[model samples]
Target: MSVTDEILTPRGPARVDTDVPAGAPVALLVLGHGAGGGVDAPDLLALRDAAVAAGLVVVRVTQPYRVAGRRAPAPAGHLDEAWSVVLGVLRDRHTGLPLVVGGRSSGARVACRTATTVGAAGVVALAFPLHPPGRPERSRAAELGTGLPTLVVNGDRDPFGVPESGPDVRVVTRPGERHDLRGDPSGTAAVVRDWLRDRGWTPA
Candidate 1:
């Protein structure tokens, strides 16, 4: 089943839509949405279901700006602050349950930026925008180039550009999908499942 709750953050009150696994859960995965999207993105929905089936609790977070019904997302710093508040709620509620933080698009960028702040076990960056649409000079690769364990599932045809593979960052490309990757997520789901399993987050 699903449940929704709100938490006050520095920016405002953000909402979290939680999907719990049927059986016991050993971990929690918190995902934020793209700049122009919500928890209803097909990839996020699929990931929620797949993760639940794999015995994880997945929470889809709506930033405070979205909660206020704004189409434009707040600045990166604001996003991080609001996300930190949401992460705190999950951490307190789940206690020892390990946490994996991630998101799609802008959300993915936020996850990478705040991974350590939230003490995430690892980070899943779905369709991470390696750079702004046509501005290849202003690359965001530095964000994903950290030593932390990171999984990047990017659309090969994404206008945002596909990041090159790195030692600690594993890059998985999705064919035929752009930044949205909303139509079908089977391949993306499999990648995430295997990544988690390889890291021992899921039973081998």
Candidate 2:
């Protein structure tokens, strides 16, 4: 079952929906939605189901602006601050389990920016926006790896550009997907499992 929680952050009230595996969890995944989306995105829901069945706790977070019924995303600093607050609240609740931070689009960028500070074991970026459309000078690839094992799933035709793979980064492309990744996320979930296995992590 999934439960929603209202978390107070510096910016506003953010919401999170959490799902846990039937058995003991091996790790926890904290996923954030994109700038214009909510926690109910198809990709997010798919990931949540896949991870839960594989014995992980999954939490989908809606940013403060989204919770307030705003379409425009908050500033990067505000987003990051709110995310930090959310983690602070969940940290004690899931102590001793490894945390993997992840998100889609702009949320993916936020995860990358905050992973190091939170000591995340991994990052899952779905349709990561490498740079704005028609703008290559504002590259955000440096945030991709962040000195941790990372998995990036993207659409082959995404206007955001194809993200490059590095030693710490593994990129998976969906032939028919666009930036939305519009369909089941089982493939991306399997990629996430493989990445964890490569790092010697297995579901309990």
lDDT of 1 by residue, 84-169 (tens): 98898889998888899999999999999998888898999999999898999989999886567899998878999999888889
TM-score result, candidate 1: 0.97
How far off is residue 131 in model 1, in Å?
0.7
Predicted candidate 2 versus true structure: per-residue lDDT over 13-62, tens digit per residue: 98989898888888889999999988788888888888888778899989
Clashes of each: 0, 0
Q: Worst lDDT window (10 residues) for model 1?
A: 182-191
lDDT of 2: 0.87
Which candidate number has the best lDDT?
1
Residue 81 in candidate 1, Cα distance off native in Å: 0.5
RMSD of each: 1.0, 1.3
Model 2 lDDT at residue 168: 87
